[model samples]
Target: MRHRRPEDRRPPWGVRRTVFSGLVPLVVLFGWFTLAIRLGLPSAEPVGFLPFVFVAFAALVGFGRWLARAGILLALLGLLPVLAVLLGGWTATGDEILLSRGKPVVVLVSAESAHRLKAGLAYTYDVRNPDGSTDSLEPGVGTRLPVGSQVTVVEDPDRLVAPQLAGRQDPAVPLVFACLGTASLVAVVVSTAVAGERRRVRNATTR
Candidate 1:
């Protein structure tokens, strides 16, 4: 078996340090903005702001190579909120401009299509609107509701994002994501604990 390297057994640097000045604020701003959108707050256009956040993530990762694991973890955790919002876990504020689906009208799904490749599949469909409108919807990840099936579609007059399938998502997608997130969190916690214990043992031996 391979032995641990001296560097691997050492503790990570503290979060408070002169070397991390430029990195901290960028992380806070992007994390706060993404979390705000995730919490069901209204934004005039939320998706449009992601490019800047992506740039910030890239810059932070490049500048903080010494803390690569921690930087990467922070960025990935920051994205959990955005993923939840996209997955329909939190889409409305109960006051989004008329709440077209408050009482939630259900209509026959007019058309449907799905495309598949090695990466994954994207599903979309059109549905008859509550007020006699035809809204095309690209809904959250799930089993695609078939054409001629009945589904509720939620839209806003303010048009913050795509019209969402009111309640047509398959239960499997969210369950899978929840499992993955929990596993990742557990792995992170266990690894940190092991590392801390190793550091303590190394210090005790030195004494």
Candidate 2:
């Protein structure tokens, strides 16, 4: 009937350790992504970030035994944002295809504004078309232009999509999201496999 020491009673994987294990990989991934974008690297697609994802998963598997279940859950949750971004990109692509058949128009930027997004700053311009019609155009994230600047854009004849900047259809933003989503799926699969193998080994040892 000896009393157990407090340290001995504590679980091997404490709350702080679990949190650190989970957050370290995420922080590292965020830093790498930001650096890639700043350096103008080819990070617009899922393939570009595959190496980083592999490293992240490796770290989790090697160092975070308790994190496998959490990783699977987080990975599943991550798919929501990926789906939303892909849906938006699909709609935009369809609009662009429709606008391509229409004539190009030169629009004057009447006003300019900047907004802060999660990734970075995005610019919006109030553009005046030749027909005296005005519309707001987003040139994309990290783009900036002075007011009164003239830009060429393809206008949709059926108004299916808003006027889009000509020669500026960069899929970087959407593809980045796709990369993250793919990484999450990979994490789920790897974590599940690791967990199952570990459980099988423990069962064999106990028997």
Candidate 3:
């Protein structure tokens, strides 16, 4: 059998750095999700398949220059969700507005006073409209509007049945966040492994 050359014997440094970098995001996301659950938010079950993917990618890219490139790509991809959350870009799209006769300003009577609907709630009439007409809505209409609050009716304001707070719950937002997280984790693992292997080789050469 032909002898293995020393140059081809070891892995690259970039892989080591990628592995470490990947772990940083993983820890952060795990801590965040744990805190969210403690804070009474509904947290989705953890994805079980991610660790295997990370291991596989790291093994495949180990000692390869491609690990360095992948590390950069993943780090950049991870930023997408972060920016979306920060800039209020996580709001849902394709929202439909409906028409309803509304008073410019109405006093919130109470949560109990709001008419409960199948998916949302409606505000009850305790005040008159600008046209001085008695405003009445179906029991479930306008239910999404918060009680004890005042809203401006620029146009007929049809609200969501399960109205989330403004600028919350974008489908794209969570998906991007998850993607960023997964990619970053993989990059970290691969890069870290490569870097460690390179360090070993360098140390061996010096000795």
Candidate 4:
């Protein structure tokens, strides 16, 4: 019965390890963003499918065994904006109700305006459109919203995910961002460390 030497056991597969490393972060991110959507993120614009593309890129590149860990870091760094944009979508979606309705949100205008919305609420900071045009103010929450003037419109009591305009705005967005960000960072760090350790082991065996 002959025992096989470590190197004789065949070089450890690289692509599989890298692919697995990339996938771990993606699954976590998907879960987070999905949950965010479920919680009803507000936005005036429709959410798009760009997040999946970047995540896929990260996963596929992780399988590039020829690349150094630093290269992997850069690849992952490039994906950050995609992730942020996706999360920004969630933020916008969750807040869209107010914006669409032109809800009055209290924003501090010049030093003289002493108006303040109730704490923990969402409001619109209506400003003149960039084209330097003005529209007649209507009788909605944001009606007569002046330049730099802030006002808080009453929150719709009916919707479950309606953003609170009076007490506690969307608090979940920051948490979701932190969770996803931390997970991505950890994935990169762990993958790099593992790659380094593997190189060390290989070197010892070859000596």
Q: Each prediction's TM-score against the native?
A: 0.42, 0.44, 0.30, 0.32
- In the range 74-96, model 2's lDDT, one tens digit per residue, is 44454453343343344344344
Rank by lDDT, descending? 2, 1, 4, 3
Q: Among these predicted structures, which one has the highest lDDT?
A: 2
lDDT of each: 0.50, 0.57, 0.39, 0.46
- Give one digit per residue, the lDDT tens place, for model 3 in 1-207: 999899877765545455665555456544543343233211111122235334433433432333333444443443443333222211112112211232234433233344454656554433234445433322234545444455443223432222222233345655455556545545545454456556656778999
Q: Mind giving the per-residue lDDT tens digits that candidate 1 earns over 1-207? A: 999999877655532232244335445544644564454333322344466457645543443333333456545654553344333322333233324433455767888877663546767677786668776666644557878888766556555444655554344555455445435433433344344445545677999
Candidate 2, 95: how far from true, in Å? 5.9
Clashes of 3: 24
Residue ranges of candidate 2 with Cα displaced over 4 Å: 1-88, 91-99, 170-207
Q: Number of clashes in model 1?
A: 0
How high a TM-score does candidate 2 get?
A: 0.44
| Stretches of candidate 1 exceeding 4 Å from the true structure | 1-57, 65-102, 117-120, 139-142, 154-163, 166-207
For candidate 4, write residues 76-193 as lDDT tens digits: 5636743553555455454554444433434232222222334322223322323353222112133233556644433333332333333333436744674665466456645664
Model 2 RMSD vs true structure? 13.6
